[model samples]
Target: MALTTKGNLGPGRTEQSAFDAVHSAKRKDLWFAAGGLFVLAIAMSLLFTLIGDLIIRGTQYIDYDFMTSYPSRLPERAGILSAWVGSLLVMLVTAFLAVPVGIAAGLYLEEYARKGWFSDFIEINVSNLAGVPSIIYGLLALGMFVYGMGLGQTILVAGMTLALLILPIVIVSTREAVRSIPQIVKEGAYGIGADQWQVMWNYIIPAARPGIMTGAIVGLSRAIGETAPLITIGALTFIAFLPSPPVTGEFPFISFAWLHDGFTVLPIQMFNWVSRPQPEFHIAAAATGVVLIALTFSLNGIAIWIRYRLRKQHRN
Candidate 1:
């Protein structure tokens, strides 16, 4: 290579030469960027390949009937109607029980709990619980809720089991979100004569909403896919009947009977199909998998949209 001095180039060309020289000096960074791109490309390739295979194999079996019909022994006629509805009901109960309690626990731990040995012990356990296998939660729910409390293997039991499974995740997410709020923001609120409750409700919660929502969505997604815990709770895989609605034709007909009814969820249903020896059921399982993935992604998208809207409103 020929060496060139600044004087060798004209005024306009001199800065361009220096810029090129600086970039050329970092040959290692260029190689690193190329290597990172290659790895990402490989990962994306595997993902797309799996998705493509699933769609190709399952698309023929997907139809409106598949979404509305109950499971049948015949793969050609089988549908996930009972499975999807049961999953929805169970998740409703899970969210209802988990979100409020999780958020409250998080709030108390982060804001009100005294810094002491007991507090530290609770925090450590919460972190540890977040990593515990989902199956263990099932066994605990079985021992405590089913046989111990006599709730039996019902939709309510399944939902409560999942609630316990995801509670730590929600609490952790909530605390992290609250912790991110600038101390000055709280100080400013207090400076303006705001009380603790008002400061948290009006300022901290709103600011932390995005992170809290992200965590909740992730936790719910995990709960939705969980199979072992529900199985441990004795969720029947062959359920054909829908839980009775909370209300009927009569006046003041609301009821909680449905919560106590037997149920089956998407994961359990898919497991049943996959366990079958027939190849056709495999296709059905793939179709069910697609639907499950779509449901999860839809929830995540909704959460993201809500976060975006809230942040936009906050900026305004």
Candidate 2:
């Protein structure tokens, strides 16, 4: 009886210890989750407060005339016509130059490049580039595009600078998206006798399109708000005229002359207005901020919609 009681005591104590350990672990997890939630709530609250304030201050100035007219010295007559138009043109150029090249570079690195020290080196540099300051890119562009190549401070130069800025982001996102696809999918393609290029074109790219688009749009969102790089490249702040129309009634029906035109984007224009001591200019700056925010939100919405549609299509 004595021996049996001692054996039972050991088992009972072991069970109690394990039970206590589990509860302790759960308590730790709960505390961690609570901390994370607190941080997130604080961040979201601040963001909403700032956005609400901007909307309140800017709502009065967002009229049709404000949209159509050009920037002027008088705050009452100043508008964002040239600013928005230039922004659109520069974005068009950035997308055209960056999208294809970034995707191609990502594909080559992931699908074709031999896994070696050189490839590893390239990968590390690419990742590092994504975190480099925007100002550094501005300096690089100033030296390379503005001086070395003699592109001047034009729409083309601005576009190329932004394109370079976003290339690393797009490449990283593409590689990650491609990597997420199940290995079984690639095996199946191989089983069906599809070659590498065929598999990439027909299966891989389609599956990764959603992620690729999301990354590209996110990068563009960052680029659109950039002020330092464009300023470094000598973007004008008070342009009253529009670039020559991109579409024409001539033989070619398209014109590239606008690429060489001087430009001013929304952020720069906003900065110009905000720098003044007058209260009226401050109001105009608030209005410009509202427009910029709306444009950014629109881009983000498009990205989300694209991602959702692609995911649904893949499931179907």
Candidate 3:
């Protein structure tokens, strides 16, 4: 009986210790969760505060005239027509240049490239490039596109610069999206004697489309707001004129001359306004900032809607 009592006490003590450890772990998890919420609240508060301030300062300045007229020396007459139009044209170029190339490169790396040191090296470099400073890309564009290629400080050069800046982002996103597709999906395609291209085209791409679009949205969002690369490549800050109209009334009915025209984007325009000492100019800058933010949100909203549609279709 004495020996049995000692054994029972030993098991009870072990159970008690286990219970204590679990309780302590739960306490730690609760503390960590609370800490995370506190941090998130602080971050959200700051973002809302900044956005609120911008809206309050710029609300009075935003109107139809502000959207239609050009930037002027007088703050009351100043507008963002040229700036917003330039931003639109530049983004058009960026999306055209980046999307296909990034998606193709990602497909090659993930599906076709041989597993080797060279491929690994390429992967590492691609990942690293996503984190590279925007200014470096600007400098690169200054040297390569502006000087070497003689594209001049035009919309084309700015587009190419931003394309390069966001290429890694799109590629990474594509690859990740592709990876997220179930392996069995590809296997099923292969087991049915479908070739690589067919499997990729009919199966993988459709399933991965939503993620790829999301990545493009993120990359373009970053590209649209980038000032360093565009400024470094000599984007104008105070342009008062729009790029030549992209469409022509002539026989071709399309024109490419606008691609070569000098441009000013919203960020640079806002920078120009904000640098002035006048209070009115500052208000104009706030308005410009508001427009820029609205444009970005609009783009994101469109992309998100498209992505949602794609996901719904895929699920169906």
lDDT of each: 0.91, 0.93, 0.93
Candidate 1 global CA lDDT score: 0.91
lDDT tens readout by residue for model 2, 106-140: 98999999999999999999999999998889899
TM-score of each: 0.91, 0.94, 0.94
Q: Candidate 2, which segments miss by more than 4 Å at Cα?
A: 1-14
lDDT by residue for model 3 (1-316), tens: 3456443234355687887787799999999999999999999999999988998999889999999999999888999999999999999999999999999999899999998999999999999999999999999999999999999999999999999999999999999999999999899999999999999999999999999999998899999999988999999888888888878999788899999999999999999888999999999989988888988898799789989999999999
lDDT: which is higher, 1 or 3?
3
Candidate 2, residue 37: CA error in Å? Answer: 2.0
lDDT of candidate 2 vs native?
Answer: 0.93
Show where candidate 3 strays beyond 4 Å.
1-14
| Clashes in predicted model 3 | 0
Model 3 residue 222 lDDT score: 90
- List model 1 lDDT by residue over 1-316, tens digit each: 9877657444465687786776687787899999999999999999999988888887788899999889999888899999999999999999999999999899889988998999999999999999999999999999999999999999899999999999999999999999999999989998999988998899889988888888887889889999999987888998777999978778778878899999999989999999999999999999998888888889889888988987798778
Provide the lDDT at 251 for model 1. Answer: 73
